[model samples]
Target: MKVANKNIVVTGGGNGVGRELTLKLLSKGAKVIAIDVNQFALQETFRISGKNPNLLIRVLDITDKESVFNFAEEIVSSLGHIDGVINNAGIIQPFIDLKDLKFEQIDRIMNVNFFGTLYMTKAFLNHLLTRPEAHIVNVASMGGFFPFPGQNSYGASKAAVKLMTEGLYSELLGTNVHVSIVFPGGIATDIMKNSDITDKAASDSEKNSKLLLSPAAAASKIISGMEKNKYRLFVGKDSKIMNFMYGINAGFATRLIKRVMGSKMSMEA
Candidate 1:
């Protein structure tokens, strides 16, 4: 897809992947509408982006369906057309087991990740379908394929996205609308810091974060895949490695991962 002049919306366009993506799109000359729940973060992104002519920010809560629909209406009223949507808004809960997980937390995760994706997709369908070739890219995670301990809720939400996006792709097979899913292994961002629900202790010796890929690196990979209209793309070498390992022996590998990560968590605790 030609990068310049295209209309694009990127959710969670604040201080991490979203921020970098919005910046890149603007640099490429795309008209961008950046959406985020935190007005402060959105403002920070704008400040960093430095008054681009092709950018707008919407401070929004993705879980609010009414707000999303209204926001879509507003965008259509102004832009007249939307060429693509990056369903990138998502939340990760504190590392905890299901039994220890609060009902509120689970609801928050589901509402923001799964239902939010649905709401955005639904809200923008008319606009996207109107275009001859439109794109909807949903960011699932490697955890979607293999459940990660202490992140069961997050994993479940992303797994649903994986299936939902695939279903979307198949459903729109004959239509001009194109849907793609992304499964990033790990990308270094303040995601964990942004997601920390409450005060927690840390181990003295820091272990390397699994999120090894930088946001810029991830953005490049994403844009590359979108250009080819690939159905799915993994952002990191580790993502591909995980895919292979999981595909080869899911049961065994899953257990092995759990053991390893569990050991780390235990040590940290």
Candidate 2:
């Protein structure tokens, strides 16, 4: 499932790893359609892409199923085919306890992180099935695998994404679609700013650390995995290590994450 010369769609392409994915896919000779909720941010991504002819930027809210279907129809009609889709758009819940989180806040996180990915995948799945070979890449998180005290809702939503992607991979077996689930650990990106979270405590902690992977490196690994049609892709060293740890002992992994992130998270509460 080489992305070169394929028609690929990337959601949340305005910033962070999504923006990097757009740039990397374009560089690999793919015709990329970058989707984002922010028009200004999409424009910024376009500007950073050197305005490549192969790149198309679209302002889209992936949570709207009707709109996603219509947009997928338009892409297939205009581009002549749909080869791949990267469900990368997502938002984080506030860094507070689950008891302190309102129902509406939980809804917002689930809608964007899980339902949004579901809608996009459903809308384009039929179109993808028509292709000789197609690909689906869904980005989950380390939090999806290991529990984070303050980011419970966010982690749950991503966990849903992880399971959904895995189910898709299983169901699509013997089909032309190559489904991949990505579990990304700490990465050097403005995800907090994008998610509208103001966690000064967590910000201070991050500033003192140099363990996060860069967006470019993460994107490179993702694209390479997609090209190889990999089933599971781990973006950072932290993701790979924690994956093994969690697999060995879930209780220990949960306690370790709590010990590491709980203090900073308590400041938000």
TM-score of each: 0.94, 0.95
Clashing pairs in 1: none
Candidate 1 lowest-lDDT run of ten: 199-208
RMSD to native, candidate 1 = 2.5
Q: How many backbone clashes does candidate 1 have?
A: 0
User: Tens digits of per-residue lDDT for model 1 on 96-146?
Assistant: 899999999999899988999999999999888889788999999988899
Full-model lDDT for every candidate? 0.86, 0.91
Q: Which candidate leads in lDDT?
A: 2
Cα error, residue 170 of model 1, in Å, equals 0.3
Model 1 misplaced stretches (Cα beyond 4 Å): 196-211
For residue 118, give model 2's deviation from the true position in Å: 0.2
